[model samples]
Target chain A: MRPFLYERADQPEAAVIAARIQGQQQAPPTAAAAQFIAGGTTILDLMKLDVMQPQTLVNVGKLPGTIEMSDQGLRLGASVKMAEAAENEIVKRDFPVIAQALQLAASQQIRNMASLGGNVLQRTRCPYFRDVSYSACNKRNPGSGCSALDGHNRNLAILGTSDKCIASYPGDFAQALIALDAQVETLGPNGGRSLAFADLHKEPGDTPNIETQLQPGELISAFVVPTGAWTRRSLYLKIRDRESYEFALASAAIALDMDGQTVRGSRIALGGVATRPWRAREAEETINGQTLNDETARGAAEAAFRGAKVYSHNAFKVELGRRTLARALLDAGRMEI
Target chain B: MGFSMSQSEKPGGLNRRSFLTATAMGATLPVIQQARAQQAESAPADPRAPVDVKLRINGRDQSLRLDARTTLLDTLREHVGLTGSKKGCDQGQCGACTVLVDGTRVLSCLTLAVMAQGSEITTIEGLASSDGALHPMQQAFIDHDAFQCGYCTPGQIMSAVACVNEGHAGTNDDIREYMSGNLCRCAAYPNIVAAINQAKNEMRKA
Candidate 1:
C-alpha cells in the first residue's frame, strides 16, 4: 500500500473541508483524492489490492456514533459499527431484516469494526475488479472491456447489466434499507441532504466509473428508517456456498404487511443477483391484496426475476433467487407478529 | 559594523538579512542556496512521509513512527514484538489477526495502527495473568484440545472470549455462528466450540 497523508476530523464540517481541499487537485473529482476512512475494512482491502489509491485519508471514525430509536423509527449513525446495529435490541425488535442482514453479511470481527456507512459503500468482490493484474475491468479502469463478461462470471450480475460491467454489488444491508424505505442523511460541502436509500447505488451503465450519486466530500451521517407496518414482519434470507462468512449467491429481503391472511402491502429486494441493490416493485405489486400462499409466493417470485438475463454458469441464480424470495415471503408471512 | 552587531543581537535571532549578509561574506551563498534547493527536491512527498502513532497495547502505551499504511497487525508483530496474533490472510477474510480494541473483537489486519490511537488494545499476549496463570478461555482451549496446528488459536480464543462476554455462546449453534470468523484449516471446530462453551460456563460460575 502506498503511504498517504492522514488527517483526523473532529467534526463533520472539518471532514468535509479537508475533503474539499483535496478534491480541488483532481478533476472530475472521485473518491481517490481524499477518501473518508471509517472502519477501514473496504478501503484498506482495496488499497492493498492496488485497486484504490488515495493520496490522503480523512478519518471520520471519531464522528458521532449514535443509535437512536423513537416513534419515528431507528436512526443509525454512519459511524456506528455493524455489529452494534445488528445486536441492538431496538433494531432486532423493530427491524429484523436490518439486523439479520448485518449479522449475515460478514464475519464477526469484520462486523465489529465495519461502520454502517462503510458497509453500504463496500465495493464489489468481483475477482477481476479486485485483482489489478486484469486490465479489462471497466469499473477499476474506465473504458476497459469487462473481463467477467467472457471470463469466470458465474457470480456476476444477472440484472442491471450493461455491456460495460457485470460485477454484482456484494452487499446485504443495502437491500434491507431499500426494502424498508430508509433515508440516507449526508453532509457535504453544500450542506446536508437526504436521499432515498434506493438512490444510493447506480446501475453499471456506460459510465460504470461513477458508482454512487454522492458528490465528492459528501459524508453519510445517518440512516433513518421510518416506522412501518412491515418492519416487524421482515426477514433477510441468504443462500451461499457456506453457512456463514461468505457472500450470498442469491438473497432476498422480504417484508409483508398482512391483514389477517391477505397482503395489504409488501416490499421485496434482491441481492447477489443484480448489479445494484435491487428492489422488486413489480413483484411487490403482484402480491398486493392477495393472500400469501405457495401459489401466490411462487407467482411473485417469478415476477421478481422476470427481466433476469443469464450466462452459462449463472442461470442457477435466477432459479435460486426466485426460490429465495418465495421462501422469505412465505416465512415472513407466517410470522405471528 | 554597528548595524551587523545590532542585527545579530536581535531577540528573534538571525534575521534573514543578517544571515544573508553572513553567507555573502563567506562567499558560499549561491552554493548554499543550490544545496537547499536540492534538499527540497530530494525530500519525500509530504503525504508519503512516516507519521508518529501512539497505541495502548497490553496495558502499556507504546509510541511508534510508522508509514501511514501500517496495519495494526504489522505494528504489533513487526514493531511491538507481539507475534502471538498470526496474520493468516492479510485480507479480512480470515480472522487470524483478531484482537480486542476497547474489549470488542476486531480484525487487526484491516485496522490501521493509527486508527487505534485512543483505544485500549488487548492481544493474545495479554490473555494470561502477570503471575503466569492462564485466562479461563486459554485454559479451556488446553483442556478441550481445541487446536492441532495452533495457527488460528489466538484469534479463536480472542473471539471466543468476546462471544461469551457478548452472550452469544449460549448454545452450540450460537458458538458456531458467532465464531465463524476464525477458520481452522486443521478442522478443529468441534473442539473449539467445546472449549468456548466450557470457558463460558467457567466464567459464569466464577
Candidate 2:
C-alpha cells in the first residue's frame, strides 16, 4: 500500500469538504485522490494490490449508522455493518431476501467489519483488474486493451458487455436492493440527493473506469427499501462453485406478488452474470399476469439471458444462469408466503 | 501515482516478464521479488508521516505513533510485539490475521491500526488468563486437536470465540458457514468444528 494521510470526519458535511480538497483526483470517483473510508474493505484491498492509490482517506464512519424498520420500509444506514442488518429481526422476518443476500455474501468476520455503503460500491473480482501485472484491463486503464476478453474470463460478465470490458459486478446485496427497487441517499458538499438504486451503477460501456454514478465527494448515506406487494415473498438464490464464501457464478433475486396461481407483479435482478446489479425487467415482464408454472419460469429465464454474450471459457454461465433463474422462480412459486 | 507499477516498467525492451509471457507463464513473480528487495533496502520508509493512536488492547492501553498505512495486524505483530496473530494473506482473503475489535471478530489485516484507536482489540496473546489458564476456546482446540501446523490457529480460535458469542454456532452447518472465512490448509475443519461445539457449551455457561 502507498503512504497516505488519514483524517476522521466527525460529520457528513465535514467529510465531503475534506474529500473535495483533493490531491490527485481523477474524473471517476474510484480513482479520486481523496476517498471516504467507512469499513475500508474494498479500498484497502485494492490499495494493497496497487490498483487504487488515493492520497488522502477521509473516515466518514461516524455518518448516521442506524437501521430503522417501519410500516413505510426498511431504512438501512450506510455505515451499518453488514452483520447488523443481516441479523436484524425485522429484516429477517419481513425481508428474508435482504438478510439472506447479506448473510450468504461474505464470511461472518467480513460482515461484522464491512459497512452497507461500502459493500454496494465493492469492485469486481476480475483477476486482470486486480493483479496490477496485467496491463490490459480496460476497467483499470481507460483505453488499455481488455485482458479478460482473451484471458481467463469464466467469471466475467456476459449480460452488460460493451466490447470494452467484461468484468462481472461482484456483489450480492446490490442484487437484492435493485430487485426491491431500493433508493440510495447520498451526502455531498453541495447537499444531499436520492436516486434509484438501479441508477447507482453504470454499465461498463466505453468507460469501465467510471463505475458508479456518484460524484467525486459524494458519500452514500442510506439505502431505503420500500414496502411493496412483493416485499414479503422475495428471496435470493446464488449458485457458486462452492456452498459458501465464494462469489456467485449465477444468482437470482426474485420477488413475486402472486394472484393465486398467476403472477401479479415481480422484480428480478441477476447477479454474477452482469456488468452491474442487473434488473431483468424483460424476465419480470414475461411472468407478470402469467401463470406461475414450469413453462412460464423457463420463459422468464430465457428472457433474462437474451442479451448474454459468452466468451471461450464462460459459455457454461449462460446455461447455468438460465437454469439458476428457472429453479429460483419455481422454488419461489412454491414459497408459503 | 496512478498504479505506478505496470508491464511497461520492465526496465528494458527485453524483460523477464516478456520472456516468460512468450513462454506462456509470464507474470506475478518478478514484481513480488522486486517489492521484497524494495522492502529490504528501506524498511519502514515512513515518507507519508505517522499518526498518533492510542489503542485499548485486552485490558491495557498503549499509545503509539504509526504510519497511516499500517494495518492492525502489522501493529499487533510488529509494534506491540504480539506475534500470535499471523499474516498468511495480508489481503483479508485468509483468516490468519483475524482479531476482535470491540468484542466482534474482524480481519485485522484489512483494518488500519489508527482506525482501531477507540476499540478494544483482543488477539490470541490476550486469550490466556494472568494465572496461565487458557481461554475455553483455546482449551477446546487442544482437546479436539483442531490444528496440525497451527498457522491459522490463532485466527481460527479468535473467530470461533466470536462465532459462539454471535449465536452463529447453533448447528454444524451454521458453524461451517460462519467459519468459512478462516482456511485451514491442513483440512482440520472437522476437528475445528468439534472444538467450537465443545467451546460453545462452555461459553454459554460462562
DockQ of each: 0.23, 0.21
Q: Model 1 residue B191 lDDT?
A: 98
Candidate 2: tens digits of C-alpha lDDT, residues A1-337: 8877565665565566556555223468988877888888888999999999876777876566899975658999999999999999989888888998998888888898899999999999999999999888889988988999988999989999988999999999999999999999998645789999999999999999999999887989999999987888889999999999999999999998989989999999999999999999999999899999999999999999998899978999999999999998888888887
Candidate 2: stretches off by over 4 Å: A23-26, A70-72, B1-47
- Clashing pairs for model 1 are none
List residue ranges in candidate 1 displaced over 4 A: A25-31, B1-45
lDDT for B72 in candidate 1 is 95
Residue range B94-181, candidate 2, lDDT tens digits: 8999999999999999998878877899999998989999999999999999999999999999999999998899999999999999
lDDT of 1 by residue, A1-337 (tens): 9767676665676666556545543333344476898899999999999888887777888777899986657899999999999989989988999999999989888998899998999989899999999999988889889999888889989999998998999999999999999999998767899999999889988977778888877899999998889999999999999999999999999888999989999999999999999999989999999998999999999999999988767889999999999999999999878
